[model samples]
Target: MRYLIVILALVMMAAPVYAVDPSEILKDPVLEKRARAISKGLRCVVCQNQSIDDSDAQLARDLRVLVRERLVAGDSDQAVVDYVVSRYGDFVLLRPPVKGATLVLWFGPVVIALIGIIGLVLFFRRQKKYAAEINRDIG
Candidate 1:
């Protein structure tokens, strides 16, 4: 019984888990592959942090179906992505384009870090000046 349980566990762990349902798969292997590729690059709006391909959310399922439908309608991979982005905005893309609108998303962290560093430097410099004055007065 323990060996059987171990084997089952191993099999489950080895299997690739995807949120995509069999019904969502395209009949054309080529189109299915494209749909999967596009799905991986899209963010799940409901989950926010998970890729649509990995999210089990109902909204993710809808997006996956939409992608397959677009591919079946003969939309190119880029066109399908564009259509989704148009409806959902750039936030749907995991790696949103570095454009004027999204520049803040790309660079906001670095800018914040710079501000923190500058503030720290100013704080330390003021502390050092205050300490020097104290020492002079004590001497």
Candidate 2:
């Protein structure tokens, strides 16, 4: 009885996920695959962390619809992405171009990591020098 109750609760929780209409299936699976691939690379402007392909937000859904609309209209993959990027700026792309404006975003992490490593090396070297001084004093 307890197991049956738990299963029923799980089923109820899962039901809302199927709210997407049955007709949402793409007529051309190949085009749909390409559309999904492109959407996966574009960030959801409203939800910066989630890709448009992965986000459940209305804006993401609309962007997804736009992607499919362009694809079916005979736009090449690069053309589709370029259209979105032009409208939203390079920030919309998961991979931004390596350019002057985005230099910090591209290289900031490596620069910080190098600084941190240098700091650690200096600290250890200073600690060793202090230990040597203390040893000399004791002798």
Candidate 3:
């Protein structure tokens, strides 16, 4: 029983989690692949954290359909994405381009990490100086 449970756990862990429905799949393999790649970069407004490809939300389904519709109409991948972005704003993109107001979103984490590192360095220096004063007084 333990061995069976372990095997099941391993199988589950190895599987990729996605919410693509059989009905949603495009008939053409090439177009389907492109649609999937585009869907993976879109955020589901309802799910918030999950990409549209991994989200079961109705909005995600609509967006996926929209993506396919645009693809079918002969729009490039970037153009399809831009159309969605135009309708839903940049928030729909999981990785929005770092331009205009999004520049902060791209660099904010780095700035925060630098601040933390600077704070840590200052704290260690202060502790070392305090230790030296204590040894000087003791000696």
Residues 1-139 of candidate 1: C-alpha lDDT, one tens digit per residue: 9999999999988968778999888889988999999999999999999999999999999999999998898889999999989989998999889999989988999999999999999999999999999999999
Please list all clashing residue pairs in model 2, or write none if there are none. none
N/CA/C clash count, model 3: 0
Write the residue-wise lDDT of candidate 2 on 1-139 in tens digits. Answer: 9999999998988845431234544689998889888988999999898788878788888888888889999999999999999999988998888999989988999999999999999999999999999999998
For candidate 1, give the lDDT: 0.93
Full ranking by TM-score: 3, 2, 1
Residue 3's lDDT in candidate 3 = 100
Error of 3 at 108 (Å): 2.5
Top lDDT hit: 1
Predicted structure with the largest TM-score when compared to the true one: 3
Per-residue CA lDDT of model 3 for 8-115, tens digit only, reads: 999988968568888888899999999999999999999889888989899998889889888988999999998988888989889878898987888999999999
Report lDDT (Cα) of residue 48, candidate 2: 99
| CA-lDDT, candidates in order | 0.93, 0.87, 0.91
Residue 121 deviation, candidate 3, in Å?
1.9
